[model samples]
Target chain A: MSDGPAIETRGVTRVFESRKGFLFREKTRTEALKGVDLVVERGAIFGLLGPNGAGKTTFTKILSTLLLPTSGTALVLGHSVTKETAWLRPRMGLVLGGERGLYNRVSGRENLRYFADLYGVPIAERERRIGEVLERVGLTDAADRRTEEYSRGMKQKLHIARGILHRPEILFLDEPTIGLDPKSARETRKLIRSLVSDGVTIFLTTHYMFEAEELCPRIAILSRGRIVARDTLDGLRTLVGGDRTFEVEAYGFEDREIESLRHLPGVSKVASEEYGPATRLTMRVRTRETTLDDVRGLLPGHPELAVRERRTSLEDVYLDLVEEEAT
Target chain B: MAASAPAYTRARSTVASLRLAVLQFMADPQWLIPSMIAPVIFGLVSFELFRGYGPYFLIYAILGAGMMSMWGQTLYGSGWATGQDRNFGTLEPTIQSPTPYLYVVLGRVLWNVVSGLFGGLIVYAVVVGAAGQPPALANPLASIALFVFVMLTLAAIGVVFAAFYVYTRYAGFIQNIGEFAFYVGTGCMFPVVLLPFAVTPIALVFPPTWALDALRYVAIPGYTGFGWGLWGDVAGAVASTAVYLAIAGLIFRRVERQVLAKGNLSDY
Candidate 1:
């Protein structure tokens, strides 16, 4: 509701310390987030892509005011998440959905009704709003069915319904489409778009590269508790090297042939690695001037060489950044 | 300062939570079976022990049995629901809502009092059946009202103990171990005046101990639990219960902050 960014963090960190041993207790502190800084604008579907244990959920939990950061600060709607939770909770929603997090014995409608009251939905429109969210999530038919009988996809839809039932200004969805079928995942993505169309800022975390590329105009890649890169899709495409890559494979390449391939037009960088019995040279080209034929021409001595050109994708950028951080 | 929900909002949430508890109880009434076991056993055993002592002794047997039933249903029932929340993974979403979790506990305890009264009636029937007659009360109406008031005091205890469940998932196990200790310490099955002087201070800390003592004064003829009589015990009960209610908010705030810091809200 403020003019500032919808979500922002400054050097936020979270460490989880657990104790073991009944008598001489031993402490184990796992730093889940290490000095992460991020900014998300309003009305944007900002995608956060990270591998397992990469701190995506931790950062989201901090931003949503579900967990306090061990150090630094996080602001949602320009209010401190730790200090101003009362103002933040009503305006924000979260979906940490699974088979759990639901009243399995109650009907989906009943679950929404309970949350509608807790969220303080207007008495005049509580039932109507629940109906709208259920319809939007494609669960009208299953609305009265006990949630324990719901399929994984149906339960997920119900989770989404409860999250948007109150119509929060921002929503934090951690892997909303994780366990859904292909069709269901696509429909979930469509729902995300519709939510953004309604002017709700979305902080989405997922492992689906294509989903992030398709939905988020801006994205961030988190690796091992740290954010390695954050930018527009094209911006991330540029970060790893360029917008195009050519994978040239041959049994082996001579020193001169490898050196000559690197000098080709628009080639910004060349990386070599063993692929099965052959050696693959990955050339990152920043321009359209380089073609597969141009690469084949340079290595004519090896007629068996296979040249494959692929446009740079978010997945490529993600792997490159995460690996870069790892090394 | 954090913004507080409007009074109406809090009240509505509390009512909604109470409704949810009722709905859940209706769906699964089997939980009532375990809570009934202890009270029925106590009623039968105490009736046998107090038989033929005196006409007033039957009053002790009945009040002691009813108090045991109300004790479990009010304190243990409310806390168990929170343990179930941890199991259902409902704790996190409920905690995340703008409505403070304390109101939710209040709602559940309110419903428990309803169920606990049902439990108290069942125990009363069991005792009367064992004794082959109903216990005579000097003032039945005042005793009934005071008995209901004693349930409210037990509710204060419930709300306070519910904070422990929110603090740790293992709270149910600890409560299980401490259940008998709570009964003996609070003197739910006997008069606190019979306890050692050193232990009386600890027993008086629980509002139900004083409230039950006051209820006895009005229920039993020639009964004097304390030298000052019914009004004195009533004063003590009201003051102690007020203290419990006052500190519940502070305790819940600290527990909530601790769980959030530990990131253990979802742990079961």
Candidate 2:
């Protein structure tokens, strides 16, 4: 083990060049990572949250040595990603989601054994480790069946089993439970928690806010190739500065009614969208100056407005941070 | 720590890769059926067409079909396998493994060569059964040794072809071109002596041409020289095999670096 942060990046950037049109007519450059710096301490579940095209996958690729940064430096387990990939690759694991990573034609046990060999697990311990991982992922009964015949959730579990087969120190998981059923997703979360309890550091990325809040003590939100915010759940909630949010469900409110609500005293932000049969309106107000009773007092005499106070959640903080960066 | 950990891991990885190649080949009917049937069909057809020239012609056809089988399998088993890995999305995972990528590829090529040799033996059986006699050899040991060497030479060339296939999206086009080009250039169906005068030099550069010529010299019993003497042909095959292996190593390393730099390992 090296005496430093488990993972660190300094001003890392990646630019992808693509050409389009006939006979190479045009060249376009997309900067996927724009001079970002991040650090993950040892033995922590660090969550990275982002929307589509936010460079989360590109960052994972750079850290795993699958792609080299266009500029700057990234170190994993104290070794340079570009110059020391051979030394660094063995100590870390990477799990990318979707159904394409495993060998569909072979049995799960065979796939595990092949990866064990690739990771150079000792011959004496290969079978025991394979069995243990299979049991841990709840794939023991299905381990002998061909992977193609397994359900998507089962295959994802097998992917997780393959990632931790060598007992790597740092694991990079990108959307591990994206399409799983509720039960399977919960089980997968349990597996991740157990992995953390065993002292393995996890770098996770997901769109599930509750999953992040439950698993990660610290989280970072990325938008448009930059880290917009990094802090704990409670810390991120403080970013809104003691603003209370109220939700109103109504059927007859139009753009005029929304404009009226925006002009009310103590209200800072008003946003609305269609939800089911009613239009859902949300307004953020300074909690020290406004109360739920005061909000109802300003509503139009249209008898359909049903109002209630909403709790602050990580999703609210995430949306606030991402929406701020977009502007 | 075990003193033999490095060697043990390399051997284990090689075996694992070999197992994967064999399983994939067996599981896919598109490759298995054609690979098993073509050489035998070609061997029988050639024997029936050339029965007037004596047993030597039968030997020629068998050996020709044998080399062709090896070449075809190299393209399909090694080169096309890499393309399939990309489509299956397993290419990145394999690259991410702790084992060196070169060894995994070499193991796959080795399986193709071995499987090709097995296919060649079947072709030989068909030739002998159809002709009612086995071809005599002037130096049996030399013929056997040369046969093993040629398979290895073809494996090295296959690795080079696979490197190109791994990096490019035109893998199918390359496989088509490589299969037909080697069949003609290596004189798989006929002697290079009958090819046009200008084409012989181009044919001479490929190791398979020298390999086939060397095999013919020892196996045909009363055979006479064409371009070089027996020892010269043998030496040429050895030298070309070395050169091809070196080129394969360099190309493999270059493509590995380029793909990592470009971040296109999973691109289909």
Candidate 3:
């Protein structure tokens, strides 16, 4: 194995320019990537979590050699993305989200064969490889059907089959399960894990925090074109300093009740929302051992409130990180 | 691997691309049927209108319709292929592949020429069957040579059209206007001498004008092949083809760079 990282970036940035007016117009520039630096180790499933328009796709495009960075450099498998695209492209595969990427009028098998030929897979190996990937993605029965007849999930599976048709060392999956149903999404996740076990380094990006926590040992939270935090799940949980969130369900949540909860000794923040005749209150506190009792002590006077302690999940950590950036 | 390994690989890639292009074209009958029918209809109408002019007019109608069909297939087909790929969301992945994008695009245009030739042959069969006599060729060998050269020249121009289609939003409108312009400016339907004097320079610059004139000169009894003599017209067509091919190469490279920089390769 090589000592170098599978993928690395140093101060990568991308700026998109567009004209705004009808005739002679002013040029508007939007900085999509802000000197971002990242590294993905080989054989590791690294996840990048971000909301829409957070520059995740832009970074993926740069790494895949589909789009050039406006400045700085990115290397995939020790090859420069911009200068060595011809060398790098064959070694890396990118599967973008959405159902429209396939040739809808052709059968799934034909599409895979076309891509196999394009990637220059050995003619002798093409049929076996195509069959293997189709079966792996659980599309063998529908392989001969035209892609236009496929469901969204089936189309997504076909996308994955094409991406790995070359058997690339590094696979970049951008929101691979974006529109899949629950069962299909779970199946797709299993397929990704199997690919990783076969020693392909996966670089995944998704807005689903549970998906990331389930698949990735390490995750990076990106906000507004920048990576705000990167660490393992347990490491990120420590960012909140062992704080616990308690949910209080009640009726008629008055302003004074929320104020009282906020004034509690261990409480840091209290948020409340009303749904019809009922109200839900969330309290973020320093420690559950001391704060849970105190929260109960303060809540009993209301009589209408029921309190329960909740675990701090990765979703909470992600929202806190992104909300911090927004503020 | 041998020293010629890269060339061999490129040839294989080009062939695969051509297969895919042909398959896609065949699957879309809406595009193929109209392209084939337009030229045949034009030839039939021309033969009816000019029946008084003897067998020469029938030959003109056949060959002229064939040339016009080639232009329409090359220009409109190339542009629509790009648009369809973009709409189907396949352009990005195709561009992202390890093979050079130019081969994929040029391969598609080559197949379009092949299909256009097939369509032309159908028109020829109809005309010859209706007229009951083959058009006379003063120099059969030279006419055959010029036909090959003209097709190649037109194919190169098609490459240029493909590049513009890949890069521009107005590709459809441009293709429509371009096909009409080539039909009129190249004198596919009428002789250039009857056109305005101001239009003569524009008409002469297009290789297809010289190409059609050369074909008419050798095939018709009194036609004078652009008034440049046989060798002069042949040389002019060859030279202009080279120039157009060079321009196409440069344009393709420029547009490719712009598309990559702007991240608009798959935008519809």
Which prediction has the highest lDDT against the true structure?
1
Per-residue C-alpha lDDT of model 3 across residues A1-327, encoded as one tens digit per residue: 456898889899899987757773988889988888898888889999998999999999899988989998899888899888777777778899597888888889999988887788888888999999999999999999989999999999999999988888889999999989999999999999999888889999999999999999988888888888888887776675335778888786668768988887667667677867888887777654455567667666667767888776889888888888889
User: Alpha-carbon error at A284 in model 2, in Å?
Assistant: 3.6
The local distance difference test score of each candidate is 0.87, 0.81, 0.80
- Residue-level lDDT of model 2, residues B179-261, one tens digit each, is 77777877766767778878788888888778778777787876654658788887887898889878877887788778877
TM-score of chain B of 1: 0.92
Candidate 3 local lDDT, B131-208, one digit each (tens): 787666667677766666667667776777777777865677777766777778878778777788787799888887
- Give the C-alpha miss distance for residue B57 in model 1, angstroms: 4.2
Q: Tens digit of lDDT per residue, candidate 1, span B21-90?
A: 9888877758657456767887888788787888777888887787777888899988888988999999
Clash number by candidate, in order: 0, 0, 0
Q: Please name the candidate that would achieve the greatest TM-score relative to the true structure.
A: 1
Report how far residue B74 has shifted in candidate 3, in Å: 2.2
For candidate 3, the docking band is acceptable
The segments of candidate 1 whose C-alpha lies over 4 angstroms from its true place after superposition are A252-260, A272-280, B1-8, B35-42
TM-score of 1: 0.95
Question: Distance from true position, residue A264, model 3, in Å?
Answer: 7.6
Residue pairs in steric clash, candidate 3? none
Off by over 4 Å in 3: A20-28, A251-281, A284-291, B1-8, B140-145
- Calculate model 1's interface RMSD in Å: 4.5
Candidate 2 vs candidate 3, TM-score winner = 2
